[model samples]
Target: MTVNEPTNHQDLAEAPAATGEVADLLAMLAKQRHFLRFTTRDLTDEQAGLVPTASELCLGGLIKHVASVERGWAAFILEGPSSMPDFTKMTEADFARRADEFKMLPGETLAGVLAEYADVARRTDELVAKLPDLSVSHPLPKAPWFEAGAQWSARRVLMHIVAETAQHAGHADIIRESLDGAKSMG
Candidate 1:
């Protein structure tokens, strides 16, 4: 049989709605990303950037943070722990730069941040699909939050991405509610 052709009738059958573990993960991540992005609908850059509640989170900033985090984790899956920084040696500037990821800076439009997030999401979805083995794993980098010497599989990383997106979507929902009584979930 040629490489492009399926060898069996089963392979020729129509695929299920989410045919595999990776597909399931991608589906979940997409739902969360949609919820997160929905919060910013009809918002101006000023509204997107406003810290409407007691906390420092803004709708645009939350989207930016989620996109940055997802991009980093997706890279970690392919490039291993080396794709991430050694949190132990993080400098003030590193922290500052991280903090900046949460703010819609001057001249920064909400549309721009959303576009970047969409791009990141697309890249991550492609990576998850193209990876050969979801079970492949790597040692986690030294970080205060991670257990020492711990390792995580590609599956785990994707799950973490889903969790992060969901958490931030909730945060965005709250921020949106505070800003204008809009509820993402009602």
Candidate 2:
């Protein structure tokens, strides 16, 4: 009924046993993801692929980059050795590789980007679901950009990702609307 209200009716039925903090976090994450999906829903391949006004960023690129970030951080907190793109030790070649990763290839379509987003998002969700202890401190060892030896609970990392994703999702929605006439999740 409202932004604060549960979208999942079944979840509401179980609310007596659920913590509001956990539910709110997860719900916000879902809202963000849903908005991203809505924004990209009707984009043509060319629209999704367009890098407008000399900017290197595109809707598809933003979605892919966010997915890569989500997987990277979640892996750091849960799976131990991270499989994410290493921005720290990234060489010129690595930046070049990322340049390619950000652009839509010859065969890439909006549908393809959506599929990739869903796949990455699902993996991120699974990583969060399987955490042994959300409150246990786990240093993001490879992220030197973070304070040296700084630690975060798995919950905090996940919440950060969700918040970051939501912010970018807003950007994607605006870009998509400008590119076409699509709008999405609040």
lDDT of 2 at 175: 79
TM-score of each: 0.90, 0.78
Model 1 ranges with Cα > 4 A deviation? 1-18
The residue-level lDDT of candidate 2 at 63 comes to 73
Q: Global lDDT of each model?
A: 0.84, 0.66
Name the best candidate (by lDDT): 1
Superposed Cα deviation of residue 51, candidate 1 (Å): 0.3
Worst 10 residues of 1 by lDDT: 6-15
Clashing pairs in 2: none
Question: In lDDT terms, how accurate is model 1?
Answer: 0.84
